[model samples]
Target: MNSVQKLGFSENAKLLIIHADDAGLSHSENMATIQSLEEGFVNSYSIMVPCPWFYEMAVYAKNNPKFDYGIHLTLTCEWENYKFGPVSPVSEVPSLVDENGYFYKKREQLRKSATPEDVKKELQAQVEKAIKFGLKPTHLDSHMYSVGSDAKFLKVYKEIGEKFDLPVLINKQLMQMVGLDPDINIKEGEFVIDNTYIGEFKYFEDGKLGDFYKGIIENLTSGINLILIHPAFDDSEMKGVTINHPNFGSQWRQIDFDFFTSEINKAKLKENNIELVTWGDLNKIRKGK
Candidate 1:
């Protein structure tokens, strides 16, 4: 049988994977994630373990263990003022860090400079930190698809996932067409929502964000559908934090908030009989297997 069949997901029912990215970035991100979780617009979220406010989010997770969360394994510090130092000491994984002691500025720089051994060491350090902080993560994924893009990195990441017995996201198309192997050795879950399913979510756009409700009209398939969103307030905090980011993750995140909470989108889903789900379900299914 194929990967999806191995995971035990029903082939007929459409599964929705609404995951919120960037959970431990700032207060804006934290508040947004909580609101989205309560609102039922987002099913899963990942935390940047190396972020400055990581412990705070970890505490929240410990208290409210019901939320489905994963580690957004961070290898690079993309922001300027907002940056995190390496979890592994400089002496241990010197290549993963810069002269100033933080991680490299970009993925390309890290990919070029870091050795496979150094990458593995840093990943272990980050995961250890999360466990130290009392986070029983539901799954594993990269912050910027760092593991998925590089073969060596992917190997280390998958090793960790298998060691921990956690479920990870690996696009089937990438596996076939791009030759991106799974970071872990486990069989693919029964449920599968390929990227093509997510590519169809045009729920929210600029200006007329209200018009996105029309998207729910399309009949959804029975398989899983993962909808990725980055939601945050365009407050002074997010603005100041993401000043140099041209893609404006903070600003674009605010746009996600608009789209997710829009009544049009909610009504459309209700009208189309779409059911939302969380990664917690996937974790349970994988754990049962």
Candidate 2:
């Protein structure tokens, strides 16, 4: 039986996970994520353990044990002014960081300077730290999909997820986005979502990001699907954090928050017969629960 079958869904079931990425990046992000999860179609989210507002989200996650959250393994600090680093001491995972000790700004920088051992070490440290903070993370994923930048890093990602008995976001589109051959990178028997969607830059630029999302729900197909989003307020704080970056910047995140939280999108999901699933629901497959 396939994973969908394992989940007790029919062979033709249309499973969709509307996942909010970057949950703990800032107070604005954390608050937006909580609001989306509680009152919107965003059923799952992930935490950036090294971020400044991690404690805020961690407390909320621990208190609300029923919500689905995951560890977003982070190795790159993408913002111009905002930066974060490894949960492991910089001295031990020095290769993963820049000369100033913050994580590198891009995936290519991480792939060039980081060792597989250091990548694995820091990512595992992030998971451990989340656990120590009383978070019951349902799965694991990556920030910027950095794990796909290197084949060795991909292996390390799968290994860490297996070590903790959690699902890691693995899909052909995600690997191909980072220029990896999914056929070569993915092994047999691994859980791979069939489809994943993220708003294209052109769509975001054209002010049709909401249209793109509505179309996804309207035309969603069978098998496991995921729509990755970054939900945050478009306030001055987010504008500062994402200054000079207009692609997934503050306004972009605000659109994501608006679309996902709106009742229209919720109606679209039901109208198209899309079954919303969470990482915690997938986690049960590992335990035969």
Candidate 3:
């Protein structure tokens, strides 16, 4: 039996947490995530509760409670045209929402004017909304790593996580769960990458996708490794929405999908016998299965 199955999870032997982020951002993302989960390519996913399509994804979760899912705490609406406002009222979270009634476009912008009280209220509202929709999220994480960058935000996030009895992804926890620290720099372009973090989550700038595959292969850890990736097909809709976004839009996300399913990645995982586990199984292990 594989590590996850040994721990009394589903008979599937591998223990992986292949998650698709921004589930409610667009139909393309939602469809891809569902397909990947059905195909056994992705084991878990997270939803952006503030986005337009959040209700659809929430309904899917309610119908399929067996699917390991979580909340991707959305503090900013990075994309234009397809923007989302705060889950709480504008009066309550005015610091997080912009003048146009949408959330801030970037972390730095939010940090400049945001307060801890507003963040706490907004986060609680998100959780309440999810529960109201009959969704019991498996875990919690920031949409754009907003909680991790600021100490005040991190404190609120951790408190909310504990209150909900959910695990919040932390570099300290990740390092402790996994064996070693990665060698590369963890920060890139307003995004913070955690080294205890396995996987190449950074945007590929002038580098081949092979390098990312190699990075994951070379850095496989003994315990649970949670790698985050945004997978989407490069279509006109996604392009139009995300084009000119500094984060490389669908190009980087498509490359992430390719790297995740690449031959080199398969070979490395098979060679190392690394298990792909979901957060559910990982939590079980943490709780001393």
Top candidate on TM-score is 2
Instruction: Give the whole-model CA lDDT for all candidates, comma-separated.
Output: 0.69, 0.92, 0.69
TM-score of each: 0.82, 0.98, 0.80
Q: Sum up the clashes in candidate 3.
A: 4
For model 1, the stretches where C-alpha displacement exceeds 4 angstroms are 1-10, 172-193, 196-220
lDDT of 3 at 162: 78
Q: Which residues of candidate 3, in runs, are more than 4 Å off?
A: 1-16, 172-203, 246-248, 261-268, 286-289
RMSD of each: 4.1, 1.0, 6.4
Q: Name the top lDDT candidate.
A: 2
The reply for model 2, stretches above 4 Å from the true place, is none
By lDDT, the better pick of 1 and 2 is 2
Comparing 2 and 3 on lDDT, the stronger one = 2
Consecutive 10-residue window with the lowest summed lDDT within model 2: 280-289
lDDT of 3 at 156: 85
The true-versus-predicted C-alpha distance at residue 82 of model 3, in Å, is 2.8
For model 1, residues 182-278, the per-residue Cα lDDT tens digits are 3442244433345422211233224433343234235565556666666789898888788877364566778777777666666666666666666
Q: Quick one: ranking by TM-score, best first?
A: 2, 1, 3
